[model samples]
Target: MTTREWAGDAETRQVTEVASERELRELIGEPNDRAANKIRSRLHDLDRQWLARSPFCYLATADAEGRCDVSPKGDPAGFTLVLDDATLAIPDRPGNKRLDGFRNILANPQVGLNYVLPGRSDTLRINGRGRILRDAPFFDDMVVKGNRPRLALLVEIDEVFYHCSKAFLRSQLWQPESWQPDAVPSRARIAKGIEAPDIPLEQLEAHYGAGYADRLYG
Candidate 1:
């Protein structure tokens, strides 16, 4: 990603940052009734409808020490299993073996999820506790493209709400013209540069090439 310089002069920056809640609230006042009162302890009918159509979400988790990680999870629409009004199960898709977010969940059950749909400006936010399940009766329900997840993350809802579209509007995330997927470096080149200098560039490129998508379920 290209980094841009701050548009303001350095001299105009504030000398002291607003560190306290009082000072922070003074800058951005309290939320309105609609915003503050919209949180629900469990999923509503509409929330269920939303999850049924959402193909992607961001999973946020933190370890016991508060070190955080946010990972993107996606599948065909209705991939999330709504076990009950307060319970949800997300299949563990194949990906890098790092398991950063999963490791965080093992140490700290608390988690946050932001569900998004393509072209939608608003988002669904869920805060809950999570645990990993090696297998469940519902695993059959999570099958996709002839592959069933070996594990899944179960979340017990604590709070659920709809977030405003201010951030989405500001960033124009749904706009294709705003996208710069190659603004940084290609995945293969990046891996060869930082993670595997000894690996041949051709080999890395081929590993991340056209056949990459075929391995999504592998």
Candidate 2:
């Protein structure tokens, strides 16, 4: 595959530097002026539903140069391992090819997460320090999609917060009774873009069907 270009350029967004860590901490003392409610949260805050019911999550991380990648992971509820009052471990399942997110974690452990419920409006956001592990019992714990995951990532919860689901509420994310998939992007279209030297479209798809089950279940 060719190098993928970023959709947005740096010039598109305004960037500003906060003076210092100490200055930012000092500023957190004052309460919010927004409304009678919706106050900013502290580190120790833990919302139960955020951990218990989320079947899907997005992980965001960047390298030292600020080039970033966000990866999506999903499983049944309780797939994530709560290492403690302050840590979480998400098992890395099998994938098609790339390992961009895992590589970024090695370069910069600073990471962020957005956890969304299947049909719930509210979402949880967590920013934490993380590391990747490739050991046994840990992998065996979060196993799903059949085989044990080869690797798992652990994140120390430095911050935990939630977004009021105005966007989701308005869009009726919980109204799954009206949901629809956008489309099935064809392998031909994808191969035309990536110029993968794999095979003809029919053969490629057949290979996926025949090869995937054996690798995952064989």
lDDT of each: 0.93, 0.74
Whose lDDT is greatest here?
A: 1
Q: In model 2, which range of ten residues has the least summed lDDT?
A: 36-45
Q: What is the lDDT of candidate 1?
A: 0.93
**Stretches of model 1 off by over 4 angstroms after superposition:** 1-15
What TM-score fits each model?
0.90, 0.69
How high is the lDDT of residue 180 in model 2? 67
**In TM-score terms, which candidate is top?**
1
- Residues 1-218 of candidate 2: C-alpha lDDT, one tens digit per residue: 12334446554544444567676767666546553354333433355546777788999999878899999988788677776677788988778658888888888899999888777777888888888888857676776656677788988877777777899978876786767644655555577457765666776666555565566423
Report the lDDT tens digits of candidate 1 across residue range 53-158: 9999999999999999999999999899999999999999888789999999999999999999889999999999999999999999999988899889999999
Clashing pairs in 2: none
